[model samples]
Target: MNAIGKTAIGLVFALLLSPARAADINAGKSRAAACMGCHGSAGVSNSGLFPSLAGQSRTYLEAQLKHFRSGERVNATMNAMAKDLKDEEIQNLAAYYAGLPGKSAGGDAKLAAAGKEKAAMCMGCHGNELRGNGQFPKLAGQHPDYIARQLTDFKSGARKAGPMNPLAQSLSEDDIKALAEYAGSLH
Candidate 1:
């Protein structure tokens, strides 16, 4: 190949192969004190209504925070939480949360087992491990409170989604709780 062509190709290859830089975990932890009120110090939330942040993908966390900040994803609490955060702070928070270990679900065994069977319907998109795929949030090891709230939102039409709406509408309250317990038990 010609010298100019080779240089251009080399540059393109370099750009394509560049590794993505992750945010500093230590810096993230230092800045995460304010988040502990809800997310917990180790990222395992005691409150079920708030999602557990531990072990979540940093990319997903950053994206969601950005979305909330931009008003693309609307939640009064999230909006207020995200409003004043700078980009670096968001990245740090994501890094900190992603570094924490996930908690195990401590729900009832019989109910969780029954819920496992019900969760078959969710596996199509959430993955057999319940770790979730693109745009589908991970359910495994998540707080039951968050799961219950989301399920309620789906059923009430408060959370809108073409596919999820139909599925949620079909689920009874018992079914939702069972599935939430099952999902929490996954990891």
Candidate 2:
């Protein structure tokens, strides 16, 4: 090969071997300031209405954010908020939130007990502790109200979360309440 062709091949090899860019937590924290209104400080939602983002899987968070950005996951506020975010910003935000500690909402003992019985089915996807696995979002420390709301949405076809729709459809109102209580009570 000529000198120019050799140099081009060498550059391509170098580019292919280069390490992927890492997420910047500091930048993420700065970007997340706008999200704190409802997502809470440090990604922990103070209210039961919003789902806590702290300690969630980065992959799951990124996917959800992208879905919202693309209008695939329909949420009025999220779609609007995520619309302007760049790919790097989403990665950084997911990394920042995933590094924080998780917290759970306490619930009635009886309700939690009932929910625990049904939670076994959830273990397959969410893991034994309900901390989530792969693309699934963490449920261990989520708020009961948020959990119930999402489940209800899935059941009613208001939310379209793949397997969750059919699974939620199988749950009764009481089952949702019980499961939310149980899932929320987890640490």
Candidate 3:
């Protein structure tokens, strides 16, 4: 190629390979307006159908958003929402949600105890009270019904998770319920 042609191609490649801009938390809030309906006004859903997003780890949120966008996880609503999300938007959204405080779910004492036992093995990855770590999400304040749905979906291969997939397969329905209850009981 001629020098001018090479220069033009180099510029195109540079633009294509350029790193994404830093996430804008303010812009994320605006983008998240559409998510408030199901996820909650501040990331806590009033209904049990959706998982709360407030106080979840940014890393976890980012990973899940990428998964939804890539179809590694299946959820019609999330897939569509994430499909057009830019990389910076994902980072910003995660930051915005992670910065909020999370509320815990309510559960029966007996059931919570049982769930604690069930969740004991998960502490290493999920953190104390299953509040989550860098790449894991906080579950302490999530709704029991939502937790149950997620666990069931993971167990049934409907969600298609990496660690949760096989781990859930080893648990019975009752175990899943107990775990969800325990997680819900945590604040």
Candidate 4:
């Protein structure tokens, strides 16, 4: 390669590795205090009504927060909570939540086994481990009830996830339950 090409490549690498615009985890920690009421401490939820956020992809968290703030995703509480947040605050919160450890919701053996078969459809987007990619939210260790509810919303057109709407519409009620059980049980 030419010297100029080499120099450009080096600069690109440096930029990718640079911490410039990185989320301030300390700031996120304080900002997250207000979120604890429903999302629980460190982004782990204690109730089925909420989904845990610990160890989630930073990008996914950031996207969701932006969605809530923009009124693109329609959850009343999340909309209100995210409305006034600045972009930096959103980045910080996402970083903080993504740094925490995650836990599984443990499931019945039989139920998980049945759900495992159905969960194959999710592998393409959610990944083989169901841990998710940068663009998708991890399904492993999430609350089954929360997963089911989200799936139901997608299926019913109450929620507007791009590809999820059509995909979820194809799922039967039993399929949703089974997939949720299997996914939630994964660590």
Highest lDDT against the true fold, candidate? 2
Q: TM-score, each model?
A: 0.84, 0.91, 0.85, 0.89
Better of 2 and 4 by lDDT: 2
lDDT measured at residue 102 in model 3 versus the true structure, 0 to 100: 90
lDDT of 3 by residue, 3-109 (tens): 99999999999999999677788988999999999999999887889999999998999999999999887889999999988888999999899888898778878
Q: Distance from true position, residue 172, model 2, in Å?
A: 0.9
Would you give me the overall lDDT of model 1? 0.82
lDDT of 1 by residue, 94-171 (tens): 888877778776676777898898998998887777876655667898766678789889899998766888899999
Write model 4 residue lDDT over 18-125, tens digit each, in one string. Answer: 987879999999999999999989687877899899989999999999999999988899999999999999999999999999888887678888899998889899
Best by TM-score: 2
Clash pairs for candidate 1:
48-145, 48-146, 49-145
Worst 10 residues of 3 by lDDT: 20-29
lDDT of 2: 0.92
Please say which candidate is ahead in TM-score: 1 or 3: 3
How many collisions per candidate? 3, 0, 1, 0
Give the whole-model CA lDDT for all candidates, comma-separated.
0.82, 0.92, 0.89, 0.91
Q: Give the CA lDDT, 0 to 100, for residue 67 in model 2.
A: 98
